[model samples]
Target chain A: MIEIKNIIKSFNESTIVNNVSTTFLKGKTNLIIGQSGSGKTVLLKCLLGLHTPDSGEIIYDGVSNKKMNDSSKTLLRREMGMVFQGSALFDSMTVIENVMFPLTMLSDKNDEEIREKAEIAIQRVELEKAYDKLPSELSGGMQKRVAIARAIVMNPKYLFCDEPNSGLDPRTSIIIDKLIQEITKEFNITTIINSHDMNSVMEIGEKIIFLVDGEKNWEGTNKEIFKTTNQSVTDFVYSSELLKKVKKYL
Target chain B: MFYLSDIGKYFIMIKMSFFKPSKWKVLRKLIFKEINDLIIESIPIVAILSFFIGAVISIQTALNLSSPFISKSLIGFATRQSVILEFAPTFMSIIMAGKVGSYITSSIGTMRVTEQIDALEVMGINPLNYLVFPKIVALLFYPFVITISMFVAIFGGFLAMTFAGVPSEAYISGIQMEFEPYHIVYAYIKTFLFAIILATVPSYHGFYMKGGALEVGKASTLSFVWTSIIIIVVNFIITQLLLS
Candidate 1:
């Protein structure tokens, strides 16, 4: 489990993530949902240690980020995995090589052992046929799967996905969402996804934190989201006409 | 002020790149790959350009030394001196600043735009150590390329003189005249320094670059410009310090 306490981040004089605190439970898909420019990415970057918060503590299990030195932080990062929005696979590397990269760099395992592990992760993502294909040869959905395989090959304690569904079709988005949820459950990892996709929010958001501007405006489950009377939440959750019709039925 | 901060950042980047080095095994593979990419692949262009330029320099020298009073060997001597002292080292490096420098920038900039650098950081790897250090190691062999350039260029000069009906013996003797070995040393020193600039300045631009595909192109242009400018400036300074 990861606990955020009073995290405040700013750029220039304007705050991007105000003193927002939340708990992301282990073995659950924790979603941070907000509109564009609403601090979702900023908050996610803070969690990933890509951006340092001006004030507050992010405690991984019991260790606060403030207490960890650079090496310690790096060590901690080894236990974490990230799937970027663009699926950030190394363009020059093939699927299996991409998945095997972290192991090749960080693991003490022999080549055969590393290959076996990478093959297992590839199989898990159902991308065995694409083992030798470069990222450019893969489709959008296949690329995201490769990214997921690479992220999970290390068996991280924490998983972070930054808009994993962006640019993907609706069907592919759901599959990616379900895959992440399943991975979170199977690994019992603390999975935090930064997204604005309402479908993802409803499908895999076991714990949802809603941000308006830089502050948390609402916190609830998907079921709770539909029933909540909060004006801003309703306005966002049912912003679309199709969603409004669905909410009317609900 | 922006330049000052960027300069400071460049130093800091170099410092950090040496920190927390990657595993030697992985770095070994990366170094070999970079050597193949940056050095071996560049040989054809260097050889071709040197040959043509050397031929031109010899031909020009031969035409200018048509006076019966001037020794015909002076044409070969002038060509050899010009090739070794300035042309091979300075001109070739300026050309590489366009070729190799832009390549390093665009490749790394593409990585940045695509977030591959971020991915490395997330994996607890030092992106600089993983990416830049190998390039530096690979380019340490750059003098090998320069040496080839020097030999091919002198050979082109020899061939050009012979084909132009100049006495081959006179040209060969001229090339052997007053060979100050220190000039070769000075040229190599410049070559080595240019190699470092070729690797680092482009890397700095690429690594720190922001934005998308268009920005990557912009960074490549910027890197090439900066690299060429630095090479020329450094060449002037080294020439003044050593030759003068």
Candidate 2:
């Protein structure tokens, strides 16, 4: 579990994430939903240690981020995994090589053992046929799966996905969302997803935090989101006419 | 102020690149790949340019020394001085700043735009050590490239001189005339410094670049400009300190 305590981050004179505190529980898909320029990415970067908060603290399980030294942060990061929006697979490496990279760099295991572990991760993602294909040869959905396989190959305790469904079709997006949800539950990992996809929020958001202009506007479960009377939450959750009709039916 | 900050940042980047080294296995592979990319692949261009330029230098020197008072051996002497002191080391490096510098920038900038650098950082790897260190190490063999350029260029001069009806013996004797070993040392020193600049400056531009695909192109161009400027300035300084 990760506990965010009033985390505030700013760039230059502009504040991007302001006094936002929330708990992301283990074995659940915690989604941070916001419109464009609503600070979702900034907040995620703060959580990922890519951006340091100007104030407030983030505690990973029991250890405070501010208290950890560089080496400790590096060690903690080794137990973490990330899937970028672009599915940032190394362009030159084959799928199996991409999945095996972290192990090749960090693991003390032999080559055969590393290969076996990578194969298991690839099989978990059902990408066995793409083992030798480069990322450019893969489709959008396949690349996302490769990214997921690479992320989980190390058996990370924390998984972060930045807009994992972006650039994917609705059907492929749903599959990616379900895969992430299933993996989170199976591994009992603290999975935090930054997304604005309403379908993702409703389908897999066990806990949701809605941000408006860098501050938390509402927090609830997927079921509770429909019933919430908060104007900002309702306006965002039912922004589309189709979603408005769905909310009416609900 | 912008330049000052960038200079400071460049030093910090250089310092960080040597910190927390990668595993020997990973580093060995990266180093070898970089050697192939930055060093071995550069040989053909160096050889071709040196051969033609050396021929030109000998031809130009022979034409200018047409006076009956000037010895034919002076053509070889002038070619040797020009190629060793300036052409082979300094001029070839400037060309590399365009060829190799732009390549390093574009490749790294593309990775930045695509978030591969961020992926490495998120995985707890030092992206600088992984990306830049191997290039630096690989370019340590740059003097070897320069050495080849020197040999090929002088051979071109030899051929051109003989073809121009200067006796082979006169041209050979001229090449051996008043040869200072320190001049070769000075040339190699410049080669080594230029190699590091070639590796690092473009990397700095690419690694720190912002925005998308269009910006990657802009960064590559900008890196090339900065690398060439730094190379010329450093060459001037080295020449002043050593040759003066």
Candidate 3:
């Protein structure tokens, strides 16, 4: 579980992440849905300890990220995994090497063990054939899958994904989203996703947090999200053309 | 002038960079992960640079020795001294500044632009300590190697001159006559310091880079400029102190 309380982040004179607060539930896909520049990414970064909140506290499990020592922060990180927006696979590494990076960096596992674990993680994502391929050799969807495998190979207690479906086609995006949902439930990990895609929300957003200009405007389950009529949330949800067509039927 | 806020951030970043050595594990991972890149990415350029430098320095020393008053046998000795005292260290740093500095800057800058640096931080990795330290360590790892490589290169130039029917014995004698412990020591000290600066400056520029590919190019350019200017200026200071 993760708790963020009254986090404020600013650049120059402008406040980027205003006094926002929310909790990401364990064993569920907690989706933070917002438009670009809505500060969802910033909030996620704050939670990840990438950007220090100007004021407020983020608790990973029970440890306050703002107050932890370097070792503690690193220890916390070893328990967390991230699938980056661009896949961000180590370009120089082979697919297996990419999957095994966390093990190599964080675990005391031997090379054989690391390789075996990495292969399993890669295979779980159905990327067995691509183990020898570089990230550049993979399609957008495959890269995301590899990134997902890398993230989970460590069996992290927390998994963070930033726009994992951003560049992929609709079918692949659904597959990636469902994969994240299944992984979160199976591992019983606290998974947080910063996403704007409605299809993902409908498919895997167990608990949805709508962020508008850095504030948490609405919080509900995916099923309740459609029924509750928060104007800003509705406007945001319908603003997408795909969601607009979905809205006409409702 | 940049804002005071930027200055403050710079100071904080610097503090984190030097004092936070606990991320040595991350540094090790970065080094091992990219070893091939560091070695393979750099060789062809190093070969071309060292070859040209060796040939040119030897030729220059030979041309200067055309006066009959100076024994022709001194040319080799002079070339060796020149390479050790100046070319092997200073010019090597310059070549490394071009190759390594730009590479570090562009690579780190690219990481920054692409948010991979952010990803590291999200994983609670110290971006600088993780990324920059390995490069700094690599510079430390290979400075002596590069110096030796440059030495071999300059010696090759001597061989070229001799094989080309220009007198070669004079050059070898010239190197022997001028060879001194103090001179070699001084060059080595200068070289070690240059290597440290050469590693740090571009990484610093690259770490703070913003925007897209254009910013990466700018950072790369700045790395070269800063590394070059600092190397030359430091060379002068070291020269003055050593001479004094």
Candidate 4:
């Protein structure tokens, strides 16, 4: 489990993530949803240790991130896995190689063991046959699966996916979301996803934090989202007339 | 202040690059890959350019000698002096500053734009150690490339002089005349310094570059320009300090 207390971040005199606090439970898909410029990415970056919060404490399972030294930070980071919005697979490496990279770099496992582990991760993502293919050869959805495989191959206790379903088709998006949800439950990992996709919110968001203009506007489960009285959350969630009508029916 | 800050940052990057690698086994592979990619692949171009430049220098020297008192062998002497002391090392480095330098900048910049560096960082890897250290290690072999250039340049000059009807015996005599072995040492020193510039300057540009594909192009161009300028300046300083 990860606990953040009063996290605040700013860049160039502009506050990007305002004072916010939340807890992300283990064995669940936690989502941070916000529109563009709503501090979703900035908040995620702070959580990932890519950006240090201007103030407040980020505690990972009872340990505060701010107090860790460089070596401790690296050790903590190794226990965490991240899937970038772009997938960020090494363009030159094959799918299997990409998945096995973290192990190859940080683990003492032999090559054969690493290969077996990578193959399993690839198979879990249903990409067993695409092991030798470069990232460029894969479609956007396939690339996301590769990224997911890479992220999970490390058996990370914490998983962070930044806009995993971006640019993907609806069916593929749902499949990716479900895969992440299943992986989170199976591994009992504390998974945090930064996304603005309503479909993702409704499908896999067991716990959701909604941000508006850098502040935490609302926080609830997917079911609570439809019934919430918060005007900003309702306005953003049901911006389309069709969604508004659906909300009325709900 | 910005310039001073950048200088500080660059040194910090250099300092960080020497950190203990997470896995030397993986680093060994990276070093070998960079050697093959950056050095071995560069040989053909280096060879072609060095040969032609050497031939041109000899031909030009022979043509300009109008004094009857001057010996034909002076062409060989001049070629040796020019190619060894400057052309083979400095000029060839300039060529590499374009070919290899642009490649380093654009590739790393693309990685940055695509967030691969972020991926590396989140994976508990120091991106600088993982990326730049191997290039620096591989480029330490750069003097080997320059040494090849020196040999080929002199041989090409000999061939050009021979074909142009300059007396071989006189040229050979000049080649053997008043040979200072320290000139080779000076050239190697310059080559080593140039190699450091080649590895770091472009990497600094690419690593710190912002924006997307267009910015990568601009960074590559800037990397080449700055690398060339630094090489020229360093060459002047080394020459003045060592030779004068």
Q: Rate the local accuracy (lDDT) of all candidates.
A: 0.94, 0.94, 0.81, 0.94
Off by over 4 Å in 1: none
Better of 1 and 3 by DockQ: 1
What is the lDDT for A27 in model 1? 99
Question: Model 4, range B1-244, lDDT digits (tens) per residue?
Answer: 9989988998888888888575888889999999998899999999998899889999999999868898999999999999999998899999999999999999999999999999999999999999899999999999999989988988889999999988888878878889999998999999999998999989999999999999999999999999999999999999998899
Q: How would the docking of model 1 be graded?
A: high
Greater DockQ among 2 and 4 belongs to 2
lDDT for each residue of candidate 3 in A45-151, tens digit (9 for 90 to 100): 87777778899989988878767887888788778889999988877779998898778766788889999999999989999999899988999999999989988
Q: Residues A116-162, candidate 4, lDDT per residue (tens digit)? A: 99999999999988999999999999999999999999999999999
Fraction of native Cα-Cα interface contacts (under 8 Å, chains A and B) also present in model 4: 0.91
lDDT of 4 at B39: 95
- Candidate 4: residue pairs that collide: none
Per-model TM against the reference: 0.99, 0.99, 0.88, 0.98
Collision count of model 4: 0
Please list the residue runs of candidate 4 whose C-alpha ends up more than 4 Å from where it truly belongs after superposition.
none
Q: Summarize candidate 2's per-residue lDDT along B1-244 as a digit string, tens digits.
A: 9999999999998889999888998999999998999889999999999999999999999989989999989988999999999998889998998888999999999999999999999999999999999989999999999999999999999998878888999999999999999999999999999999999999999999999999999999999899989999999999999999
Worst 10 residues of 4 chain B by lDDT: B13-22
The Cα error of candidate 4 at residue B134, in Å, is 0.4
Cα lDDT tens digits, model 1, B127-214, are 9999899998889999999999998998999999888898999989999999999999999999999999999999999999999999
Global fold similarity of model 4 (TM-score): 0.98
